[model samples]
Structure formats: C-alpha cells, structure tokens
Target: MEELTLTTPALLFSAISLIMLAYTNRFLAYAAVIRNLSEKYRERPQDSLIRQIDNLKLRLNLTRWMQIFGISSLLLCVLTMFLIYINQHVVAVWIFGTALILLILSLAFLIREIQISAQALQHHLSDMEESLKK
Candidate 1:
C-alpha cells in the first residue's frame, strides 16, 4: 500500500463540505414542511394530514441520521489528516477507510429517504387521480 499523506484525506474536505451543505438544506426544507403541516393539523385535524405528519416524522429521523453519519465522516477525515500530519500513517489509513464507510452509509440513508419521499408523492398523485375519476 502507498504511504498515506495529509493531502490524501484533505481531498475529502471539499466533497464533504458540499455534501454537508446539501444535507443542511434538506433538513431546513423538512422543517418548513413540518411547520406548515402542524398549522394545518391544528386548524382541522384530518386522517390524511396525520398520515402525512407521520411520514414526515420518519423522514425527519432518516435525515437526522444522514446528517449524523455525514458529519462523523467529515470529522474522521479531519482526524485522518491530523494523524497523517503527526506521522501516524497506518492509523491514518484506517481512519480514512472508516470515514469512507461512514460516507457510504450516509448516502444509503439519503437513498432511502428519497424513496420514501417519492412514494409519498405517488400516494398524493393516486388520490388526485381517484378524485378526478369520481
């Protein structure tokens, strides 16, 4: 295996920063939706609204996990760079590998969240189609 250098882990800095920004944006969007749904539910509670809120709750949890893992990955990447800087090349390589794994897990959660979001949209579309047919 090639020697682990500070530059190697440093490479993830930009990519991780971009991913974290995107995740934060997603989280903010979800918060807005939840707030809007809460107001509607308060005005007049309905089964559909309750269902939507439930779905949002699950999605929110998933988003939280995604952020957690992504941030952890970024943190690990930084730690890896520090290790390399201090001449701990072997440990740095291990830390970098773990960081990569965490990133992959974060992306998996994102994929699951997107799937749930698409399914929710599909449900709304189906309801609209049924109403139109009536």
Candidate 2:
C-alpha cells in the first residue's frame, strides 16, 4: 500500500462538503413538504393524506440517518488528516478507510430514499389516473 499523507484525506474535503450541502438541501425540502402536508391533513384528514404523511415520515428518518453517516465520514476524514499531521500514519490509514466505508453507507441510504420518493410519486400518478377514469 502507498504511504498515507495529509493530502490524501484532504482530497475528500471538497467532495464531502458538496455532499453535505446537498443533504442539507434535501433536509430543507422535506421540512417544507411536511409543513404543507401537516396543514392539509389538519383541514381534511383523509386516508390518502395519512398514507402520504407516513411515507414522508419514513423518508425523513432515512434522510436524518444519511446526514449522520455523511457527517461522521467527514469528521473521520478530518481526524485522519490530524493523525497524519501527528505522524500516526498507520492509524490515519485505518481511519481514512473507515471514513470511506461511512461515505458508502451514506450513499446507500440515499439510494433507498430516492427509491421511496419515486414510489411515492408513482402512487400519486396512479391516483390521478384513477380520478381521470372516474
């Protein structure tokens, strides 16, 4: 294996930063949608609305986990750089590897969330089709 250096972990800094930004944006969008859904549910209280809210709740939890893992990865990367700075090359390599695993987990959660979102949209489209038939 190649010798681990400070610059190695530094490379992930910008990539992780951009990913965190995208996660934050996704979180904000979910919050807005939940607020709107809450108001609508309060006014009408339909079964369909309840289902949608439940789906959103699951998606929101997934989003939270995604952020947690992503942030943890970023933190680990920073720690890896610190470890290298202090001449702990072996530990730094291990930490950097763990950080990469965390990032992979975060992306996996993101894929699941996107799949759920697509399913939710499909449900809406099906409902619209049914209404049109009626």
Candidate 3:
C-alpha cells in the first residue's frame, strides 16, 4: 500500500480539475464576447457580423463538447486514482493517460478554431481599410 502512494491518482485529478475550470472560464468569456458582438452589430443583411455569428455558433457548440470531455476526464482521473490505490496499476495508468491525451486533443481543436477566427477578422478588417482608402 505504501508503494501505491507514489501512484496516487489524486494528483492527476486535481490537475485535471483545475485545467477544466480554466477552460470553462475561457469558454464562458468567449461566449460573452460573442453575445455582446451579436447584440451590438447584428445586421439582418449579409455583413461581417454574419461571419462572426457563424463563428460564435460553432464555438458555442465546441464549448459544449469541451464541457463533456472535461467532465469525462475528471471522472476517469478520480476512478483511476482509486483503482491505483487498490494496486490496479495497468488499467489505471492506461485509462488516466488516455483521458489526459483526449483532453489535450480537445484543447488543440479549440486553439485552431480560435486561430481561424482571428484570421477571418484580420482579412475582413484589411479589406475594409482598403475600401476606405479607395
């Protein structure tokens, strides 16, 4: 039992919980930004706001996925820790590692989505500046 202390799953669970909380907070802020923009610059006709709306909708959906994945990871970490405490080494490590990897992959997808949004906004702003100069 003493040897199993080194493999305590509580550490993983704690870290996972913190990471999930941070990610959730970030997504909430992002949603707030989108809501504000949608309310302020919402035009019926086609405009930059349309693209923003599309991006916001997609992001919100992705955020929901993040929540699901975060909770799954959290649960897996807690379960893995308990299993490890009972000396179930193989399955615990395998599952906890898998959950961590999945969580990382989910975050990667979000980063890419945000990058696309930034690029779109930059292109639109540049085009607008060009038109103004004309």
- Two-way lDDT contest, 2 vs 3, winner: 2
Q: Which stretches of candidate 1 lie over 4 Å from their true place?
A: none
- Give the C-alpha miss distance for residue 123 in model 3, angstroms: 3.4
lDDT of 3: 0.73
**Relative to the true structure, how large is the alpha-carbon lDDT of every model?**
0.93, 0.94, 0.73
Off by over 4 Å in 3: 1-8, 41-44
Pairs that clash in candidate 1: none
How does each model score on TM-score?
A: 0.97, 0.98, 0.73
Backbone clash pairs for candidate 2 read none
lDDT of 2 by residue, 45-124 (tens): 99999999999999999989999999999999999999999999999999999999999999999999999999999999
Evaluated with lDDT, which candidate comes out highest?
2
Worst 10 residues of 3 by lDDT: 1-10
* C-alpha lDDT of candidate 1 relative to the true structure: 0.93
Candidate 3, residue 38: lDDT: 68
Please give, for residues 9-100, the per-residue lDDT of candidate 1 as tens digits: 78888988998898899899999999999999999999999989999999999999999999999999999988988889888899999999
